[model samples]
Target: MEKNQKPLLIILAFFSIYVIWGSTYLLNKIAVNELPPFMLAATRFTVAGILIFIIAMMMGKSIAISWRQLKNTIIAGFLFLSFGNGVVVWALRFVDSGFAALEVSAQPLIVLVLMRILQGKKIQLMSIVGVILGLIGIYLLVSQKQILSQENSILGMSMIFLCMLSWAYGSIFVGKADLPRNHFVNTGYQMLMAGIMLAISSLLFNETWSSPWVWSSPVQLSVLLLIVFGSIVAFTSFNYLLKVVSPEKVATSTYVNPIIALVLGWYFLEEEVTLQSIMAAVVLLTGVYFINTKRKFMVFTRFFRS
Candidate 1:
C-alpha cells in the first residue's frame, strides 16, 4: 500500500469499528435476555478467539510468544475483555441498550484520565475540553425519563462506567506493555486468555448450559452474529487501525459508536430517540472532532501564514 493510502485504510477501519461495535450493544441486549451474561460473553469470545487463532496459523503467522509476553497479554485481556466487555453484557440486562452504549462510549475520556494519572502524561487542553463535553453528553443521555424511572438505573450506569474504566486501564497497560510484533497474533492470544477467564467466571457465577439449548433461534442467531461481527471482525479491524493510526484518532470511533447505537436501537428495539439524545450525540461528536482536529488546524494555520 502507498503511504497515503494507509491513512485512508485506517479511516475505513475506524468506521467499521464504530458501526459494528455500536450494533453489538443491541445484539448483546437480545442475547443476554436468552443467555446469562458471562456465559454469553464467554462463548462469544471463545468462538471468535478460536477462529482468529486458526486463521492466523493458516496464514503462516507465528502464534508463539515469550512466556512473559503471554503473561502480560493475559492480564491485559482479563482486565479489558473479561471485566470491561463482560460487565457491559451484565449491565445491558438491566439498562436500555442505547444507554449502555452511551455509557461505554465514554471510554476515550476515561483513557485520557488513566494515561494522565498512571503514566504521568500531560493532559492536553483539547482532551480536557473533550472530557467535559463528553460528561455533559452523558448527563443528557441519562436524563431520559425512561432511564430516570428505572429503580436500578444508578447501579446499572455504575456498572457501565466501571466497564469503561476497566477497558481504559487495559488499553493503557497494553500500550505500555511489550507484546508480539504482529497485532493479529497478539489479539488472538489476548482473546483466548480473556475467553478462558470469562468462561471460568461464568461457570462460577451463573452456570447454565440448558438455556443455550432452550433459547429461540433468533437469539442463537444474534449470538452468532455478535461472535462473527462484533468480537472477531471489529476487534481485528480495531487492532489494525491502532497500528496504522494515532491512538487519539482511533479513539474517535468511541464518539461515532453512540450515534450508530442510537439509530440501531430506534430501528430494531423501537426505542425512542428524543431531541435531548440527539443533542447529546452532537455535543459528543463535536468534542471528539475538536480534540482530534485542533492540532491539524494549528498546522494548517501555520502553513498558510508562512
Candidate 2:
C-alpha cells in the first residue's frame, strides 16, 4: 500500500472494526433465538477457525506449535472465547445484547486491577480511580430499575461481567506467554480450542439438537455474519490496524463498540434504551478511557517531574 492509500485503509479498517463487531452482538442475539448459545458459538468459531487456518496455511504461515504453546493456547482460548464470548452469547437470552456489551466494556479496569494483583504491577492512583469509577458504573447499570424488573437480567448481566474478567485475565496471560509467531495463525488455533470447549459445554449442559429445531433463513444469515464479518473481517482489520496505528488509537474500539451496540440493539432489535443504561454507558466508557490513558498520563507526569 502507498503512503496516501495507507491513511484511507486505516480509516476503512477502523470502520470495519467499529461497525462489524458492533453488529455481532445483535446478530448473536438473533441466532441464539433458535440455537443454544454454546452450539451457536461453537459452530461459528469452528468454521471461522478452519477457514482462516487454511487461508493462513495457503499464505505460508506455519500452523504448527510446540506442546507448551498448545497448552497455553488451550487455557487462553477457554478463558477468552469459551467464557468471554460463550457466556456473553448465553446472557443475550436474558438481557439485551447491548447491555452485555456494556458489561464487557468494563474489562480494561478489571485487567488493570488484575495486573496489579497477579503480576505485582504498580497500581497508580489514577488506575485505582478508574477501577472504582468502573465499578460504580457497573453497579448503576445492574441495579437499574429496568434490569431489576426483567426476568434473569441481573443474572445475565453478572455472567457478562464475569466473562469480562475472564477475558481480561486471558489477555494478560496470552501477553506473557510464548505463543505462535503469527497472530492470525495463533487466533485460528485459539478459536479452534474455544470451539472444542464450547462443544463439550453444550453436551454437558444437555442441550439437545432435534429435527424440529429448524434454522430459519434469518438465523442462517446471522450465523454467516458472525463467522464471516464478526470473526474474520473485523479481526483481520484489527490486526492490520495494530500494525499501522498506535495501540492506544486501536483501543478506542472498546468505548466505540458499546455505543454502536446500543444503537443497533435499539434500532434493529427494539431493545429498550433506558436513561439508566445511557448514563451507565457514559460512566463506564469514561472509566475505560481513563484506564487506557495510563501511559500518556505517566509520560506527562514524568515530563513535569523532570
**Which prediction has the highest TM-score against the true structure?**
1
Q: Candidate 2, residues 177-295: lDDT per residue as tens digits?
A: 77675767777887898899998999999886533236888898899888888887786666555444434345567787888889988998899998988888888888777776666
Q: Residue 292's C-alpha lDDT in candidate 2?
A: 69
Off by over 4 Å in 2: 1-17, 210-213, 236-252, 295-306
Model 1: lDDT equals 0.77
RMSDs, each prediction? 3.8, 4.8
What lDDT is reached at residue 167 by model 2? 71
lDDT of 1 by residue, 1-306 (tens): 225435455555666787998888889888888788888888888888898889999999988899999998888778778898998888887887876776777777777777788879787788778878878888887888867788888888998888888877776666557877677787787788888998999889857765556789978889889888887778877766554544555666777687778888889988777788778777766666655555654452231121
Candidate 2 vs. true structure, TM-score: 0.86
lDDT scores of the candidates, listed in order: 0.77, 0.79
For each candidate in turn, the TM-score is: 0.89, 0.86
Against the correct fold, how does model 1 do in TM-score? 0.89
